[model samples]
Target chain A: MRKQWLKWLLPVLAFLVAFGLGRLDSRLYRQPIGQVIAVKTVKSVKTVDNFDNQDRTTTQEATVRFLNTSRRGQTTTITNQFTYSGTVDSPLRRGTQVFLTKSSGPWRLSNFKRDAIVLALAAFTLALLMLIVRKRLWFISASIAVNAILFTLATHIQTDASRPLVWVLFSGLAIVFAVVTALFVVGWRPVCAVVVGGTVGATALAVGLGYAIFALTGYRDLHLEAVKYVTQSPQLLFFIQIVIGSLGAVLDECSDIAISIMQLDGSGKKRFNAGMAIGRNVMGPLITVLFMIFIAETFAEAVLWLRNGNAIDQTISWVMGLGFAQSLISGFGIVIAIPLTSLLATLAGKKEVAA
Target chain B: MTTLSALALTLLVLMLAVGGKQGLSDAFALLLNAGLMILAVILIAGGFAPLAVAAVIGLIVLAVTIFLSTTDMNVAGPAFVASLLVMTGVIAVVVVGVLFSHTGGFGAEDTEDLEGFSLTVGVSFQQVLIATGLLSTLGAIAEAATAVAAGLIELGDDATAAGRQDIAQAIIGTALNTLFFGFFGGFSALFIWFAKLRYPFWEVLNDQIFAGELIQVLFSVIAVAATVPMTMWVVGRRHREEG
Candidate 1:
């Protein structure tokens, strides 16, 4: 009875703590650089239709109340124009909460109540996780939160550094992340061997294979359009993504292969053949799933191109090319990790026997 | 051949060499699944409702990938049901989160790419976001469900004395490790992209593209957590009946 109460209470407590942290984080970073105000729309004055009446841009007069800085609680009327299609710009309705930016000139609509909504969604997601997994929710949520913090810090450090430093920093961060995560999830066991082995081995293989593919293709098909805003080298960014993205699947595969081999080892069975069979069984489905993830990420873009009647080859080059390369690289990492992990587990088992 | 084609061919050869007939069949299923996704995309672009199209495509992909890849109906049937259930749950969470966040539509960075394209192209970007989220998550959900089901079934076959709880515990351990590490590694580049451009913390969190991808990851995590129990139940029940 008490245990049941704790299960429910713990998630609620965690949710409140997470919410508090989120608010504090926002407050610390919510800069007073510009006049930021929470505003509500007053009235819609007129509408101008453009591009054959397909797009309607509406002009609205809104009452804005400042949320931060010196003009807090000050209300003023500002005219804002936005597209009717809630795609490019958010369509405003009366009483809708939005952020207004006041610079040297007139105040303009910046974004809707996006931050509040995200926080709310995150809180709900946490609660949902707690309800589902009960005790394990803490570990999952804490790991994600910690990883997020580490990632943020790493990004900050990378951005402030130079080219080579950025690469070294991120690569080091990946290794650290892998080691820390392994410790947290599996503890000091044979599982840790598999996790670390698979993660490190897969990351190394991915980097090597990715570079080889790039060299072989003479770097002709590398997609640079997605990272135009990136101040750093796009090639480096691509490499970083491949290394990181391959981690999860590789770790997952490693766990599967390693665990299966451990089971065989415990039974004093033919470990090598069993490991090979498990590897063969896992590789196909794993590859298909990873490739599908890559495909799905690009699906919308591909559809947009197809809608525009673009040729299949052109669409493939622009939309699918880079994503495919990344997925393939990750898939290779996972496939290789299977055998590497099995070997690691087998060795660990032998060591146990010797002891 | 282009680098992608060369890579595909190379993967095919490697899989065939290593995995043999199973690898060949898996390769064929992947091709078919890719075709189905393309067909779904074409349908959506041709004005079909994005959600309906995504659902159909997801189901077909799950079937082809899980059923064709695995030989036994006992394993495939349970995996199929578990994946479908988890996929549905993921889609629900994503759809609700997306609708509330309104994290749909083009980003500020997308302006350069949209120079010639009309914003009034009449396609609902909101629906597009939903479809994209659903589609992106399907692979992870399917993979997790299939892994759990397959792992549990395999364990049951090998160790009849192992209870359902042991199997469940094993899968959950594997699932958590995979997912947490996966998120950390997979999203590193995207985070770096946001940082290199110096997108403010608030803006980074609020950006539609970033939010969409993050939501997809969260939904996948949820699906994985849900899948473990579901797979255990199915496989455990089967074991009991067989016993």
Candidate 2:
């Protein structure tokens, strides 16, 4: 009975704490970045349908009350135009909070109460996780928060660097991420060693295979167009993306394979064959997942092309090629990790037995 | 050979080397799965509702990827049902959150990509965003559900001896690692891009593309978290019935 109460109570407590943090974070964004204001839509003068006939362009008059800076408590009237079809244009409704940006006279309305809503949704999801997983939520949450910080720091360190330096920094970061995450997830067990080994080993193999593929095709099919806002060499960045993207999935599959092997070894059965059979069982779904992610990321681009009456072959060549390469490379990492992890797990078991 | 063909050939060889017949079948399933996604995209471009198309494709992918991969109908059945339920719940939450966030459509950075495309392409970018979000999350949900289901089934009826709590704990631990690490691994490059370009914290958080990816990762993890208990319950109940 007490356990049941604790389960419910713990999630509630987590929700409150997360909510407070979210609120605090949102408040921090309100400080003098621009003219922070609360705007109420007074009226819409005209709503014109664009050439597409699916989206509307609206012209509206809004009454804005400045919330911060020297203009605090000041009220101003502004005319705003909603040109875009989607939610990129803040939906004009009575009494919506918006940020007013003033650059050389005209005040622009943007993002209607976005931060608060995002916070609410995040709080809800966190609470749901806490309720479902109970105490394990702490480890998962800590892992996410710590990794996010590390990723940010790594990104910061890699800024404005040469190609070679970028590679060195990212590789170093990947190793640190793999070690820290494995330690946090499984502790200093033999399984942890297997995970780290599998991750690094799989990553190395994937990078090698990726480079070989790139070389074999003379880099003809490489989609440099998909590379956006690249600060370093696009070729190197693309290569790094594939390596980094494979890490988590590789680590994930490695953990699964290693754990299954450990379990089989513990049973004192035909551990090697059992591990091989388990690997076969798990690989199918793991590959499916890797391909699914690849497809999902590119589906939008495919749809956009098809909508524009582009040929299916052209779409496949332009959009699907990169996604396919990414999925295939990541999938290879996962597949290779299975055997590597199994070998490591078996060796670790032997060591334990001898010890 | 082209890079794409070479990559395909290599993966096929590796798959065969690793799991042989099972690997070959899994490869076939992956092709079918990719074909379904393309078909769904074509349909959405043809004026079909994005959410409906996404949900249908998601279900079919789950069936092909999880159910078809396994020969045992008993294990496949529970995994399919549990995954479908979890996917549906997560999609609903994600769709609602997306609508509220207004994160759909192209941002200023997309101008280069959108140069050739007409803005009035008659398709709603909002629907496109939702579709992409659903697609991104389906894989993680399916992966977690199938893993737990497969793991429990392999444990056999004797798994019940360990108690439901023990099984749930073990599955949750693995599921969390798989989902969390997979997310970071996939998006590290994007984060690096943001930092290299010197995007401010607020801007990074508010950027449409970044937000879309963030929501995808969060929803995927939520779905995985939900799948753990659902799989435990379904498999546990089946064990009870058999006993």
Candidate 3:
């Protein structure tokens, strides 16, 4: 009974705190926050673009009550122009809270205050995790917190997105992430070394192979322009991505397989076979999971292209190319890590070499 | 396209080399799943309702990924049942995320690329966002179900207090490693992209691209955390009935 409260109490408190922050955090913003009191549509025009696609361009004047800043509770009229496509701007409804961007003289709609949803969903996720994980919840939460801080800090530090230093920086970060992650999973043991080694080795091998392939091919048709926002080398950006990208699944699979193999009783060959079975079991899921994650990022953009009359092959070339290549390379890490971990297990527990 | 095809071909060969017949079949299933996903995209692009296409195709993709990837009914069957139940929940969560967060359209970063392209593709980007969320997390949910089921099935008659630990490990591990880090891999460029543009944390949180990615990652982890209990219950029933 006491433990029941011990579980529910913390999560309930967390939910309240997060939800409260979501609701009342508006005062903390430097940008303007406002509630839409009235929206009057001043103009509406239907138009056709160069591609013969038809859309309605509508302009509206919104009366906003500022909730924050020195102009608190003040009303200002801001003009909002939107299209049905909402590529850049979407129509706002009355009673919605939004962030305002200050221009030379006029206040514009920046973005919606989405933190409420993020925190609310976060609270739900935390509560569920607490209920499910029970005692080990601390470890999971701590690892996540540490990793997030480090990830953000490094990204902040490497202000130069295209700098050569990122190779050194993220490579170091990858190892730190893997080692710390392995420790959390396996927690300070001789086997920790094995798990960490398998992950780093497999990840490095996969990413290096990807690098070699891209380089050897002269980076031909790699479609570096999907990320055209990157003024410099998107390829360098991609290199850092896959190196750290493949770290997650490979580490997961390695630790899982290694731990499972360590717990079994068998000769080298028998354990190797057992390890292979376990590895194969999750391999399918891991591959699908990683590849699908890659696909999802670019899917919306690719779909937009296709809907706008771009051909499938052309869409693949420009839209899906980089993500696809990343998936393949990261996938190579996962498939190869199975045997790599199993071999480590076989070697580690080589008490009986019945081979 | 050529680079991707070549890279995929190399992965196929490597899968065969490392995993052998099993690898070959997994590769086949993966290719088929990819084809289905692309087809779903095409269907949505062809003026079909995005959510409906997403729902129908997501079911089949889960089926093929679960059934075709493995031969063991003991693992695949319960995994499939649990996945459907959880997927229903996942779809609901994603719907809430898409609606409330409004993480449906292109971001300011996309302004340059999307120039001259009409947002009026005849389908709602909001619906497209929902479909994307529904489809992307399908793999993680399905995989988590299978892993939990696999662990429990291996436990067989000895399912007891200790079995709980194994199930917990499988569930949390899947969430943290594959699904969560998969987010990192998935959003790697975007993260760098944000940093490159010097968007502060507060501003980054409000950005469309970051918000969408954030919501998707949360959806995935929530699905995973939920999957543990659902799979244990579903698979636990089978164990009880048989024993």
Record all residue pairs in model 1 with backbone atoms less than 3 Å apart, i.e. clashing: A244-B185, A245-B186, A248-B182
Model 1, chain A: how large is the TM-score? 0.78
Q: What is the descending DockQ order?
A: 3, 2, 1
2 or 3, which is superior by TM-score? 3
| iRMS of candidate 1, Å | 3.4
Candidate 1 chain A worst ten-residue window by lDDT: A27-36
Per-residue lDDT of model 1, residues A1-355, tens digit only: 6885565454336546664454334334444322224344444443333433244556656666555557656776677666644557665545455556667887766765555445655665566565555576677567667767887888888777878887888788788777776776677786686778777987697668767766787767656566433556877767777777667666666666766676664543467557767777777666665666666777666765665557776787787777777777776776667666767778777777779
| Candidate 2 lDDT tens digits, B1-243 | 778878878888888898889889888887888789888888887889888998898889888887768878877888888988888787777777677666677655566777767555556667877888777776666667776777787677666644555556655666556555555555555777788678877777666677766776667666777787787778778889888
DockQ of each: 0.45, 0.52, 0.61
Question: Which sections of candidate 2 miss by over 4 Å?
Answer: A1-27, A30-55, A70-90, A94-96, A110-113, A263-269, B154-162, B237-243
Candidate 1 local lDDT, B1-243, one digit each (tens)? 567766677667766766789878877887787688778777876778888888888898888888877888878888888888777776776777677666667767666666665565455667877887777666656666676777676665665434544555555555555555544444566677787677876777767667666666666666666676677677777778889
Candidate 2 lDDT by residue in tens digits, A182-246: 88767889889988998898888877987887887887766766765455676666666677666
Which of 2 and 3 is ahead in DockQ? 3
Candidate that beats the other on lDDT, 1 or 3, i.e. the better one: 3
**Which CAPRI category fits model 1?**
acceptable
RMSD of each: 4.6, 3.7, 3.2
Candidate 3 at B214: error in angstroms? 0.9
Worst 10 residues of 3 chain A by lDDT: A7-16
Candidate 1: which stretches are off by over 4 Å? A1-85, A93-95, A104-106, A224-229, A266-269, B151-173, B176-187, B197-200, B232-243
Compared with the true structure, model 3 gives a TM-score of: 0.93
